[model samples]
Target: ITVSNIHIKSDLAIGEEVMDSLAPFIVLKGQDINTLEGLSLRQLEEGIFFMVSPNLKKFSRLRSLDLQDCNIYLQEGKTRSRTIGRAIMVRTLSCFENLVRLDLSFNYLLGCLGEILDALKLPLEFLSLRNCDLNEDDLECLANSKHALSLQELNLSKICQFSIYDNDRISSNNLFKIVFCFKNVKLLNLAQNHFQDSSIPSFCEKLPQNLKKLQYLDIAGNVLTEDSTLQICKALAKVKTFQWFRLTCSNNLLDEALGHLNQAHENAVQAKQRICGLLSALGRTDIHIEIVKLSYAIFVDLMDVMEL
Candidate 1:
């Protein structure tokens, strides 16, 4: 059953009852229940979470759940009647054993990730936790999750950074560990986070050796410099499977970083051309073939970062 962009306030209860009776894959989005009609995003999210908590068990055959931009939270200092904790959601989620895709992005779920991960039983293929204020504890749970090896696409973009002094914020080392979990990940989005130049070395160091399956990588809108860019380029040079790479790096030093990249590209192309010319003049057909292979390798390295 699919429902979207509707006013279901008057019959909300009845609708949920009917939905509970039928164990179908349910989709609810942009809904305006009567009690939640004029509420703010956060309030609406709370309302939806509460409304769905009691009925999640009814959807035994649920396969996909998308609750993006709902601002769900594990509100504290409230009774069970007023608030739903992450554990409850996790327990409820585990009931959907056949679930494959789960999207709870654009929410404010800070902490409680350990509990959630402990309860996850679904073999999810696509998971989006973008802009959810994820922390180091969350990263730890995700790193050890069984689903990590199976997920083909993982989105952690715009995860809140709180503050530089915040102890719970995810660091470069934590990010590396989280990244190390996925062996078959083809697409990874880490845009709009607090990654910086200091984080580049660790990230490069911990990057998996067998990333030939990766096709798209987005590390845009972070704090980076020319050195950081070079480090990323060097790291990417090791992976020959990428088709698209985007690093907006819209920080203060973008121009300086870009200048360094342009110079590197120029030097690399010139050196390759010179080598190719030398090989051709030697009348060495075998050497020419080797030079062509070398030039293609260099081209692949520059192509990914140059487009950014």
Candidate 2:
């Protein structure tokens, strides 16, 4: 059957036998099933198992699959299941070789990142696993994935369980390795994680020139400092393909470093005007309008003072 502009949102449950009878001979041809637009399946009650069916492979034209805020049990009873179970679930989905986008964010899935990476050696272009209880080992597995070379966008934001604390003892080298793995990534998001200023220099040093194809980079809500921001700016300047960027250092100490970015002609015009407007509204008339001429310098000064 052919349907157009349809939206499906339900909480019904069906067993395997029922699913077999109701399975679509051909899934619809709208954005979720056919077009390049991404899918969103958030806060699902039955978890991803609801979407899984013996006949799922029939949808040969499927492209994107999004399963955000899904629930996956890490243990059964008092004992934990072997990693194989998790691997099987992911592998089942990866069988869809045509799938280009996959998002499994906020799933509380624990362990077996290796299995997930192994299954992902397909032609996926976008992947997101934000706040999925991932650790350093998981990050390493993703970085080293053979399929990662084909990935265009990756998001690992708010996965604080991976943070390196004195108790957790995750090494800096492992973190750097993960960052380096995205050398060819076109868009990357690592916001609200544990990255700090100390890790900036190493990260910049190892950043791959192959990232010239990268267009978007989001490093917001981290512990970035002025020095770290400066290092990031310098590193990004070498990338010729970057067109969009977001650095959400709301409460960080990188004002000076971010200010220096105003010197870049690309950022000077709009950024300088925005800052000047804010200052004028605050009745800081003493802050001469001429300060806008030295856009980068003003940026650095404002950053030092945390004014902009």
TM-score of each: 0.63, 0.65
Candidate 1: give the clashing pairs. 9-34
Predicted model with the maximum TM-score: 2
- The global C-alpha lDDT for each of the candidates, from Candidate 1 onward, is 0.57, 0.56
In lDDT terms, how accurate is model 1? 0.57
**Model 2 lDDT tens row, 157-246:** 666544455444344446555666666788887665667677788788756364667777766556545456556655665566655555
Q: Which 10-residue window of candidate 1 scores lowest in summed lDDT?
A: 34-43
Q: Which stretches of candidate 2 lie over 4 Å from their true place?
A: 1-39, 47-52, 74-88, 162-173, 208-210, 252-308
Candidate 1 lDDT at 36 equals: 22
lDDT of 1 by residue, 53-76 (tens): 555555555556665555467533
Model 1, TM vs. native: 0.63
Clash number for each model: 1, 4
